[model samples]
Target: MLAHLRSNPSLLKLDLYCKGIQLDDSCLVTDDGGRPILRTRAGLGSGLEAILPGGLWTNVPVTEPFAQHSPYTLHRFTSGTYWIHWQGEPVTEVALSPRPAWYDATLPNGKEMTHIGTLQGTYLGIYQAKVCEYWTAKPEKTNCKFCSVGLNLGVDDADEKSVEEVMTVVRRAREESGITYVDFNTGHYDGDTYLDILEPYILRIKEELGLLVGVQTPPHRDLKRYDGLREMGVNRVSFCFEIFDPKLFREICPGKHEEYGLDYYLEAIRYCAGLASKGPRHEPWVTNGEIIAGLEPPESSIAAIDWITSVGAVPTVCVFRPLVHTDLEDWAPPKTEEMVPVFRRLYEACMERGLPIGCAPNVHVSLVMLPEECAGLSKKRYPWQRLKLEAKKRMFKYAFERRLQTLERRVA
Candidate 1:
């Protein structure tokens, strides 16, 4: 399937996510002057690099030097030229994300605004609540073994950003950097009352910035409580089901599974989707469900996908990367070959259901990655056709320019 897709030029812009990087134990490299140039790795010798459209390749370094520590890094390289080096060797041309303007500013309370949150790509991520309730459980807890949620809870005093502080950063990011998306994710909190404390912060950011915002939370006690979120001008909501398998879900996310059973999680997601579907414009609020691949069987993963789509929500698939300092650090990630099939199957299923697979805001993969397949299955024809026509126009312009340049040389 990969070979077939590679031959079809129309199927460009492929985005792949997997556990760690390398396919086997071999180091990844791109051919430069007949020499194999080593790229980044996930760990000492782990990582995978794939050739993307236009002969561009993306190398993701996934390295785990310690039992509970794994960090992923991204690098993009062309056949003959280097664009950017994230953490390795320097490149001639680099695309660096600029610090948001508000990062350096101080708030009314004399707190440095930039210390509250940081810019990721074009999105602003604020970690207002630094502690999660799940980690406080007694021995043998199920708080998603792959997460480092509690890693910085105590030491990272600077990690917690206030609502006002985040708002100041948002204004600065928007005015100086033109950022339009903001996401808020929290560590598990011990108390159920954390939501009440967090709500006002979300409301204030939305009221002040009017930017498209996404908030991640466990299923609230009352599903209707989310209506307040929508009213607060939030554009999307993501409730994470890190692993789809019921057994693994319980084992991995014990706190969440025990607190809100699988049935309740699905119910809340469906409720949110229905609410988003009824709004004035019918622009479905970005409802998202996530599945961590490799943690469960393909069938279980597929079932989760089916469940999310059935609820009129989009499933955001995350490749299980073993993070250091997590309980599952010793576990190995699924091979890329194994992951491709799951991705293709889920992509096909979402297409058949007429569900907007990539409609979830701030998500990395969307219809853009599988344009041909998505276009073939879509009810609307304009989007894909427009893209096809644009491609043709660019090709024609290049040919015409080449011919004109040849004629000019002859005249000279």
Candidate 2:
């Protein structure tokens, strides 16, 4: 297990998620140019943001209860280097994900730029609009048991953000951070207005910045809205179902189950995936069905992956993090051995279906293990599919950069 963890950075990432790292007293993350660990983005992320070996950006758990018992500890030296030691033996040297200047900047309205949006890995993540309605449901709240969205809004994110405020932050992230993608995510809103609230921001980003843009919200009752999003140049759409097991899904995500059943989420994924071929040829589009792995059995997670890929949509598997203040705070995270098969299927299934897995430019996500990043965990190699993906990745990067350059020249 030690040798496997040492050799495969991807496996190391999964283990860190399972068994979080303990910070040595010598480590000064912020002073050393590391991003401050803030609990943002639906509460699944509340840990130290650092780059592991092999250029994998991860949000390592540090503040959680389980991390206190972890064998992995992070230490920094006087020479300004950081290393992770497992059982008092050195495992790997790591770099902090740099804190951007915009993190400290404020908008003209006196709102901090970070309150509007923050970088999740290499891209900008904006949790647009107010708290999820489920948290404020009448009589009793029905928010997801594992989600901390309600707790995070006023603490780390603003309750309300104007489109202009978002644009300002987006501009700063693009110019300063060189982010090629801007992702807007929202929790469920009354009357299914999440998409209505997001369209203006999406249009502005597409028209002005020409950066890759993605939207994650509850499945809008009207599926045709996605067709309109495709027409308007939205690059990606994601639906977070949380758990794949039908009974568990109802118990875990009561709001989602009560309003739109599990079947509806699957239908939305299938519908939006079909629109991938209908959108503008120049704009790349993908549909994602997101699930948290630790909540259900690993076999259930693998089944979810197969089902997602079967419909031409990709599966986004997040390690179920028992964030502080959430209902599931005391639950244990899934073991690394249990998760290996789930993530392994994540890679092989994508390859077998010939889905476009890793063609995006400079998209290194810290929240979840991307499908293409799981290649190291699997021994089976689809050499032909791997070759095709490499070709696609190169071509896509060239075209994306060229488009950005043209946009810059036009603005100049």
Candidate 3:
């Protein structure tokens, strides 16, 4: 089932809603930020955001318990052994993500530490503010038609997070879970000063903890703000330009489509990639261009990947989940087969340009396909990258020997 999940993430819906055992809430699932949820697992390739458990799975969001059937269920075969059952047939051995020790700790404000910075896969995800400024706009107008960030995180109308509170959780998460990357993300804010609000927090985290940082926010008019991000040792930055098709982009992300436009996104990604350099500390990924894979016509998604990669940026193709309680809640999820080919192109395009495939095993968010995971592109592995690394090692050895000889001759 785990292997199946890597290639076919749609199966995760089954893993999420599967009902085989009723474990204690604290053990596997617990309330973080007022919603019963599971923080991502490092063990699971990338962690996923999912709804509450113990219900029959439905193709669409339905309140009524009409279909009393689930394709998957959890079964503990014996002590220390577990297996997932598909339609009452045992399919494969599986284990639920272990409850992180830090999840039980408390913050300076006495709130559970988990609420401050929850682990998404191995990366810590902190949504600095609870409500998006766009939500403050007319009810119908928002950047993305399919986003439910504030609602699903159960952070609606909450107070903005203080730097101390967030830093405290970062420290605990590092000490307890060995977290390697910290990703700070925000929905639209009124003043467009999301970077400004994040700067101090980012500076402190890098100076204090020395952790790799990643930020995902709306495009800022002033690209110079990214210079501060580069100096702060940010590993990778991403822009959520949800779709590529200009017309449908306007239909889905009204605020972004009208205000920033697709060209702004392209320019922002290019500017950051050009100057935003994280010298030696962070991993080498420069930028990420995120698109909801099935949001537009599949052809546009392919074109988007091509355009993003051509500009020295990697692409993240997030499979569209039919979010509950959103305007598109009744809409169906994209077919898994359709996404397979689209993801293949995503991988191929990135590999074509030799873009870094993100900070590996760690910081893998289950929400999208990581470039290295694209098996279709793996066949044409670049031997040159390895040869380059080996050459650098050999040159370093010769240079060190020559220096040693010079020092000995001078001393003699």
TM-score, one value per model: 0.68, 0.99, 0.77
State which candidate has the highest lDDT.
2
Candidate 1 Cα misplacement greater than 4 A, ranges: 1-59, 65-115, 139-142, 154-160, 280-284, 357-412
Encode model 2's per-residue lDDT on 1-412: one tens digit a residue. Answer: 6787788998999999999999999998988788999897877889999898888999999999999999999999998999999999888889999999889999998999999998999999999899999999999999999999998888889988998999999999999999999999999998999999999999999888899999999999999999999999999999999888999999999999999999999999999999988979889999999999999999999999999999999999999889988999999988999999999999999999999998999999998999988999999899999999999999989988888889889999
Error of 3 at 346 (Å): 1.9
Task: Select the stronger candidate by TM-score from 2 and 3.
Answer: 2
Error of 2 at 320 (Å): 0.5
Model 1 Cα shift for residue 272 (angstroms):
1.1
Comparing 1 with 3 on lDDT, the higher-scoring candidate is 3
Please report, in order, the local distance difference test score of every candidate based on alpha carbons: 0.54, 0.93, 0.61
Residue 69, model 3, lDDT: 38
Ranking by lDDT: 2, 3, 1
Which 10-residue window in model 3 sums to the lowest lDDT? 39-48
Q: After superposition, how far is residue 218 of candidate 3 from its true place, in Å?
A: 0.6
How many pairs of residues in model 2 come into backbone collision? 0
Q: What is the C-alpha RMSD of each candidate to the true structure, in Å?
A: 11.5, 0.8, 8.3
Writing each residue's lDDT as its tens digit, candidate 1 over 30-116 gives 222211212111111123323334332222333454311222233444433323221243312322233344655677877665446
Runs off by more than 4 Å, candidate 3: 1-70, 87-89, 153-158, 276-285, 358-361, 376-412
- State the lDDT at 191 in candidate 1: 49
Model 3 lDDT tens row, 1-412: 4456434333444333222122222333232221134322111111223222221111221121211233544445426454545566655544344457777777656777766777654567787765566666775557366776645455321256788888888988777777767898877777787888888888887666656688988888888878767776676789988799988888878888766888899899988777634444323447888888767878889899898888888887766654545666566556555666677777677656766563333454534556655643335666775455346445544543454456457656
